[model samples]
Target: MARHLDLEEQEQLDELKHFWNQYGNLITWILIVIFGSVAAWNGWQYWQRRQAVQASFLYDEVERAAVGGDAARVEQAFKDIKDKFGRTTYAQQAGLLAGRVLAETGKADAAKSALQWVASDASDEGLQAVAKLRLAGLLVQAKDFDGALKQLTSGVPREFEPLAADRRGDIYNLQGNKDQAKLEYMKAWQGFPADSQYRPLVEVKLTALGVDVQTLKPAGEPAKS
Candidate 1:
């Protein structure tokens, strides 16, 4: 009986060795690849988190400088943010905020430069549109009518189209191009949403331009009897 048990154990050991011979290297390689991928993913996540944390702290500095109304400090803080975290959205936001503060303080050249950075380099389309629009307004104030018109000609997000048209209308009016001004004003009035808060402002503009808003109908809408 002991001899028979010894023979059966030997047979079982042989079977185990055969299985390992068939799949041992494959299993070891599969586990090595999986573990390597997990390590890489974790390392990437850590890097991203570190970047975000650093960017957030810098953004806080920018906000504080802005609130204090220190244009020079704001500009400096924005520069730091751009240098260190230009890949972050905070840098773009800093540009806009700093530009607004500069513009409010009558630093047109500085404001224009800041806004130009945001308009050209911002990753977010909405922020880019806003920056471009405000930059155009400053250009208009500086009497660079052609430059203002050029800024307005750049494409904006769909939501800003009406406002862009209205701004363009103003620029044309300033340039004494009444016909083009009227055309742009009509476009603004027509493009604006019926329920928009901005619609009334657009209405005022149209009224000033001798275009009655009440007489206008929705595009492709038939006239009432």
Candidate 2:
């Protein structure tokens, strides 16, 4: 019985040796790859966290400068945010605020630049559309009709169509194209919903153009002409 037990133990030991000899290198490589991947993932996560923290600090600075109405300081802080955290939503928001403040402070050119950046490169489509709309309005104010038209050409969200059309009408009116202005005003009227608060404004525009929307309404719902 002692000899049999010895033989069994020897057999088990030999099988383990064979298994190790067959797969030892493969097992070691698999472990190394798994640990390396884990280490890389951890490193990437740490880097992302650090970047977000840094971006947040810079965004706060932008907000402070904006609130104080310090255009120069706001510009500097916005530049830092754009340079360091351009991909962050905070940067986009800061850019909008800076653009608005700059325009209010008689820096239309600088405001256009900031709004153009947000319009062209912002990750959020809605924000991009807002920037484009505001930029287009500024261009219209500056009498850059061609540039304003170009800005309005891009496809925007459904909610902005009326505003775009209305702005286009205003531009056409400025150019003394009353016919084209009426056409755009009609389009704005059609694009607006019945319950929209802005619908009345569009109606007023159409009225000024001598087109009564009430006469254009279909049945007996609301005068969305």
Candidate 3:
């Protein structure tokens, strides 16, 4: 019985060796690929976290420079953020803040450059809309009405439509087109929500154009000719 048991064990060992000889290299490669993927994923996560932390620090530098009225520092910090972490949210926000400070400091071209970068390159649609709106305002100030109109013509997020219309109205009013201005102002007035603080301001604009808000149809109703 002992001999018989030994023979059975020998046969089992031989079968195991045959299986390993057939599948060992494939199992080894599969395990290597799995472990390599896990390591790569962990490394990618670490890199993303590190990039965000660095970008945040750079953004804080921009904010500090802006608050101190140091345009040079603001530009330098913003450049660094854009160069190294342009894909990050902090970088996008830094661009907007830098643009505001640059514009306030009389660096109109620099401000426009920063705003244009955000308008063109920002991944977030809302941020892009804000950049376009602010850029349009700057162009209006420069009497570049055509440029401003071009900026406004680009698609904006839905929530910004009323403001865009109002801006267009301002441009038309400046150009002595009272008819078109009034129409655009009416569109803005109608587009504003009932509880919006901006609605009253639009109402004021309409009143200036000799249109009575009370006489106009309520929001969501078609306007009378």
Candidate 4:
């Protein structure tokens, strides 16, 4: 029985060696790839965390400068944050903050630059739309109606569609295109939620354009209580 057991163990050992001889390189490469992927993922996660921490510090500086109403300081800090962490959420916030403060301080060109960067490059679609809307507002204030209209063209995301339509309506109205203005305002009014406070504002614009919003409600759907 001892001899039989020894023979059995030797067979198992021989089978293992044969399997290894056939596929050893493949197994080794597979393990290397799996471990390499895990290491790469871990490294990427660590890098993202580190970047977020550093970006947050700079964003705090931006907030402080904004609170103090020091536009120049806000712009400089925003530049630093954006340069170092352009892919971070904190950079998007800094851009918006710096844009507003700079615009308020009468630095229109710098404000546009910041807002334009956010509009063009933000990973968050909502932030991108917000930047475009704000940039369009700045262009409008500068009497660059064509530029404002161009900025607001499409890509505003589904939720921001109403605001974009309203902006376009305003521009059309300014340009004395009453028909187009009415069309855009109607779109804005229809897109607004019943619970939205801003709906009334859009309604006012629609009314000025001689639209009867009551007629525009979906058939058989009751207005909000």
Clashes of each: 0, 0, 0, 0
Model 1 — TM-score against the truth? 0.82
The per-residue C-alpha lDDT of model 3 at residue 2 equals 100
Candidate topping TM-score: 4
| Error in Å for residue 63 of model 2 | 2.0
Error of 3 at 47 (Å): 0.8
Clashing pairs in 2: none
Ranking by lDDT: 4, 3, 1, 2
lDDT agreement of model 4 with the native: 0.92
User: In candidate 3, which residue pairs get closer than 3 Å at backbone N, Cα or C atoms, i.e. clash?
Assistant: none
Model 1 lDDT, full chain set = 0.86
CA displacement after TM-score superposition, residue 57 of candidate 4 (Å): 0.3
Q: Write the per-residue lDDT of candidate 4 for residues 1-225, one digit (tens) a residue.
A: 999999999999999999999999999999999999999999999999999999999999999999999988998999999999999999998999899999999999999999999999999999999999999999999999998998899588988988899999999999999999998887787788888787899888888888878777632466543
Locate the minimum summed-lDDT window of 10 residues in model 1. Answer: 216-225
Q: What is the per-residue lDDT of model 1 for residues 1-225, given as tens digits with 9 covering 90 to 100?
A: 999999999999999999999999999999999999999999999987888788888889989988998888888888898888887788888889889998998889999998999888898999899998999999999999888878777878888888899999998888888889888887887788789787788788778878777788655665343
- For every candidate in turn, the CA RMSD to the true structure comes to 3.1, 3.8, 2.8, 2.5
Model 3, C-alpha of 4: deviation from truth (Å): 7.8
What is the lDDT of every predicted structure here?
A: 0.86, 0.86, 0.92, 0.92
- Model 1, runs deviating above 4 Å: 1-33, 219-225
lDDT of 3 by residue, 107-134 (tens): 9999999999999899998999899889
